[model samples]
Target: MSYKDGYKWRQKSKQGFKTKREAKEYGHVIVKELDKTALLTKDTELKDLTFKEFADMFLEIKKGHVTHNTLTMYRHAVDAYSSINNIKLSNIKPLHIQNVVNKMVSSPTTINSYYKVVSRIFYIAINPYKIISDNPCTGVRLPRVERKNMIHTISDEDLNKFAKYMREKYPQAYYFLQIARYTGMRLSEVYGLTWNDIDLKNRKISVNKQLQYVKGVITFEKTKTANSVRILPIPPILEKILIEYQTHELEFEYDLVLNPYKKNGVKCQINTYLKQFGENLSAHNLRHTYATKLLANGLDVKTVSALLGDTPAMVMKTYLHYSDEMKAAASNAVANIFS
Candidate 1:
């Protein structure tokens, strides 16, 4: 045995530690000395934890604060990491995160969400658990997301044709599509609607809850924020449709106007029905069409924003694609002033 720098070391014979027990003892002593040195160097911090283990601990701590939807997204990100199969926690670098993000470029929103989850996990591991001295994701770069145009406008002629097609093919879903195109409500918001949420006397509907399908479970959750809880006035034509739909519901013994058969059915079923109508439009596209129509009709950005339950900046940034006639009308209005 020999001693150097407060650490004890031993030299074995030509066989180099004859028994497995001797090698195990040597390893234990070396680990103990390293722990002592680490303590003396700084605070006593936990060491040698794998990334997967630390991520689990971080998510456990985060579970109570976030919504179920958010937790599911985080779990998906962790699951994706596990599927990579070749990642080593100790050797993980920023490049690994970038590589994963690059592979998910087709889904920009999902990729960004995963990056946020990874960032949060590393943050908790570094500050709370002291699992690693530094976060490997610190300098990682996220993919650039190009925001797509959300405004989808149908001409009056096209809309009339669509309405006619709906009446012929999908009589049940026709009023639902009309309501969405007029009200600008999200698919979840529409699915969560009940008789109590509507005020026929005032020609308005109140947004209180949102329906979400997480892992195939249809759950009704609160709106994202108090600001998201809004009351939108129904158009006169839409009010008439609502009255008709209510009458139809009573006649058919259905609860919901759109889906009279099921109390709380999934909104994706509506999308399926729309496809059958030859419309090929999602519920969200109805909302987009609503906003575009409002913009084309000379409504100010703020009013359209409030009606769509979005900020003015979001409305202008996302849904300001105007038609040629609308653009020409604006030009003519200015030209008339000069004339």
Candidate 2:
């Protein structure tokens, strides 16, 4: 049986009664009892766990599951949450969480990230751990900031100029940029690419893994998600560029495509070159350009999502600027059919 406590719908009991009247009476009793007593009773042993202790346990549980970068972020959040160090898990309230968040001088995005880590810790404590009855992080209001699309894709004319300049001046940067622009692969995925993963004859580039920083050392790791491990088509222009690049670069370390450059500080090097073209572009902007071009040219969302190694929902959410235009075009096409 379930009951409504003003706006909140709460489950009263899982047991079934023989009659509707009995169920109604049982639910009423439960609601009255709930109003008189606490909604959730905490265990004596677990209720006394300090916020810092629970956070440490949470980090320990997350060690192997998350990437090195993600773990570092978690640690940073843990450090920021030291103000509530001695407070018991069940004793903490929304005001406590909100106070900690209000004290942070970071940007909205950074604060949000930290809040997420804290929120996850509280959530786990409520569920499987059962250390806390309620999540204190739930009702805390975050700073509101205007969301803007950060992708600064190159124009067709500018792309041509950028490509020519990179090819002539920085062959290595050109190779990296070409792979990223054509394939819509992430920077880490590109860093993980080797000669063996490239099927040049079949015109397909396999994305099996990515380069990740683990304990200050760069190493090969599984893709970000299961969908990330996919094969992308190599366009004719990209194929030509890769072929030339492969011929010139032989006997490299790990038989990798970009042996000398590595993963660290490569973005800075590319972005420095990007500034010369008079566009505020990063390595990821190339990927955005590729996906946007595909959607603008009339590719379906599912196909584009598959090609980009992301879910259709994520593709729609991220590329809504182009997707919205596509939606408008689709509406016109439907109207034209009736006409």
Give the poorly placed runs of model 1, Cα more than 4 Å off: 1-50, 57-70, 83-93, 102-109, 123-138, 213-218, 249-257, 260-281, 320-339
Tens-place lDDT digits, model 2, residues 147-188: 666446777787777778877876667778889989999988
lDDT (Cα, tens digit) per residue for candidate 1, span 1-339: 233333546443223898999888887776665554342222322345566776677679767665577778899888666634344444577777777776763477777778788877776656655445456778777777777544445556656666776777666556666777779887667766777888989998988877665555666677755557899998899889888777664532213344533322434545664464346565567787788888777888888888877888877778656544567898999999999
Q: Which has the greatest TM-score?
A: 2
Error of 1 at 39 (Å): 16
Q: How many backbone clashes does candidate 1 have?
A: 0
Best by lDDT: 2
Candidate 1: C-alpha lDDT: 0.67
Report clash pairs, candidate 2. none
For the record, the alpha-carbon RMSD of candidate 2 to the native fold, in angstroms, is: 7.0
